[model samples]
Target: MRSVALDLGVHEISFCEVAGGAVVLRRTVRSLDSLEDLLGPSSSPARVAIEACREAWAVHDTLRNWGHDVLVVDTTRARQLGIGQHGRKNDRLDAEALAHAVERGGIPLAHVLSPHRRAIRHQLAVRRALVETRAQYVTTVRGILRACGHKLARCTTEGFLTVLSAAALPAETRQLVGPLVTALEMLTPQIALADAALEQLCTHEPVIVRLTTAPGVGLVIAAAFVSVVDEAKRFHHAHQLASYLGLVPSEDTSGGRNKQRLGAITKQGNAYLRVLLTQAAHTILRHKSGDDPLRQWANAIDERRGRHVAVVALARRLSGVLWAMWRDGTVYDAQSAAVASAKGLRLQAQSIEQQAQSMKEASVKARRRQRSIDKGLGATRATARSRPVSTSRRASMH
Candidate 1:
């Protein structure tokens, strides 16, 4: 079978065909129509390699429809395959590299998400952008007012207009800030609409509904998790899911040494999902009661470590817990969490008590050793004194 590597660009596509360990065809096509024309109708299907990019999925779908086997490789891994190492890097070189990689086999393939999951991801991304833009405008308004010596009170996005209206601002200042205020006003409604749409989407999703049962998880977080994860079965275990989300710590090991020093999270996966999980963890820690096992565990960690460490740990734990819930088709179990928390607390108490007892025994042993040394010195001095006077008297008589 032949292999075709395609380096896709906005305006053109550079491609190469390899058959029987030789470059059989190399060309540049200006459009999809031209590409089809060049390939022509053929009975034998060639393996097509496309690096995962913005247009990769669309291209993959098109090629698949054309009856060709498509392999979408991750861009990062494709680069690491020594593509364009010696000469000037260009589309042709990249295409050649991809072709050779395909022939070599073992190319890392990118997971193409389902259309439903992609739609949800798109909606979430749009909503996040709108919210961020609104926040930027809000900050700008606050800064402008502060500069003019008319500071407005901090208010929610919905209440910002009222706050701005009540603030006694100079006419010139108001004129300058009016446009930004209008922009914020426009953005607020759009954001609300997006939120409403997202809420409706979440309400229909059983996964999101089950996720929301966990403490600190609400509609937004649950939806975000569902959108990003797509499928719970992708992960074989809860820890694997956490690791995929980059919630786990990184490892640095050397020859024969099994030193596991935990550092900051890798933060390699979806940034938005990680942020939502962290926010949920923070909410749980701040507002949840001790009666809940997860809350109790978090509080214990917060007391031992600082709030920041506790929050990150809780976030990682939350990922694991959510994955477990999803995989098992079970809701959050507060009672079980509470029981585990109690058991952990008991073990901690016992460890502390054992440590204190060991310290006390060591202190007593040290005191006894000191007393024994002192007695030995005193006895030696008394013997010397008792024998010394007779020796001195005998010497004087002689």
Candidate 2:
């Protein structure tokens, strides 16, 4: 069997062809195009291997189209298995290593998204960038306003840009900040356009449709979750899915015991997905509608610990729920949600009852104090009335 390996060197592409576990041909190729001239058409089919990189997928697709088996491996694993272990690092060695890795099945083939999926991801990415940019600009306006010594009143109707433009301020402050208002005005439409594009994209994806069916998950989050997770079955279990999304707790294990360190999320997966999930979880907890097990768990945690921990835990659970739905092809069930939410609601009601009891106790105490004061005042009045005319001067009265 013959195998070809490509090393995307810094300046040039290195090509190595091996047969029977020996290098039969080695050459430097300028581009993927140069492969045809370097290695002429062969009678026997050849397997091609490449290190996973930005260009790796393109090469893999092209070579596969040309009737050759192509394997794309993790660059890190390739380095370790081929060059790192051997203490040799060079394009030639890398190419040889990739070939060996492919032959030995040490390199698991990389997955490539379909063209349609690729287009969808690109659209999602663009929308994400626009949203981030708008947030940054909004933050800048808020900071600028804060610096001008104009503290916004609570519950003000004005947004950052609106306040900046409308708030009465010194001429210098207006001059420095007025242009920002205009910029925000211009940027608002761009953000709207991005949102519209995202909405349209979401409409085309079935997974997003199903995900949006869940309470607390909006179109942006559903779409992002769908995009980041192209396959549901990749995860062995729902917990694995949650862990992959970084919604799980961090573990500190020692002395044969596992303890949750209670820190920030492990954040071991896609950060954007994690953020979306957590935000969705937060929204779910805040919304008074529909029941969710994750929300119940979160609220319980919140009461015992805090809302912060509850929200994070809820986000992790949300990830698990998504995985369950995707893996089982099941829709959200009101019965299940009800069962889950009952625990949280009961806890909430119990908390309210406890608070009411405490309030009642305080009221009783307050009433008793008022009664004591009133009684003392009445006694003093009676004593004054009983006394002979006290209005006279003390020395004259005696």
Error of 1 at 37 (Å): 2.6
lDDT of the candidates, in the order given: 0.75, 0.66
Q: Which residue segments of model 1 deviate by more than 4 Å?
A: 38-43, 84-88, 255-258, 338-398
What is the Å distance of residue 382 in model 2 from its true position?
80
Q: So what's the TM-score on candidate 1?
A: 0.78
- What's the TM-score of each model vs. the native? 0.78, 0.71
TM-score, cand. 2 vs. native: 0.71
Model 1, span 1-398: residue lDDT tens: 67889999888999898766678789898866678854545436778898888788788888878788889987656657667687668898889888887787888887787677677778899889988898888888898888888888878865787788988888999899889986775666566567656655655577776676678886678778888788887877667777778888887665767776768888877899999999988998888776877777888989998898888888887887777667766566665445533111111122455445534543453355345434434544554576546787889989
Could you tally the backbone clashes for each prediction? Answer: 0, 0
Superposition-based RMSD of candidate 1 using all C-alpha atoms, in angstroms: 30.0
**What lDDT does model 2 reach?**
0.66
Top lDDT prediction, candidate number: 1
Q: For every candidate structure, what is the RMSD over all alpha carbons to the true structure, in angstroms?
A: 30.0, 22.5
Q: Which ten contiguous residues of candidate 2 have the minimum total lDDT?
A: 341-350
lDDT of 2 by residue, 20-115 (tens): 778888988778778875433543567888777778767777777667877777554454565655476888888887777656665665556666
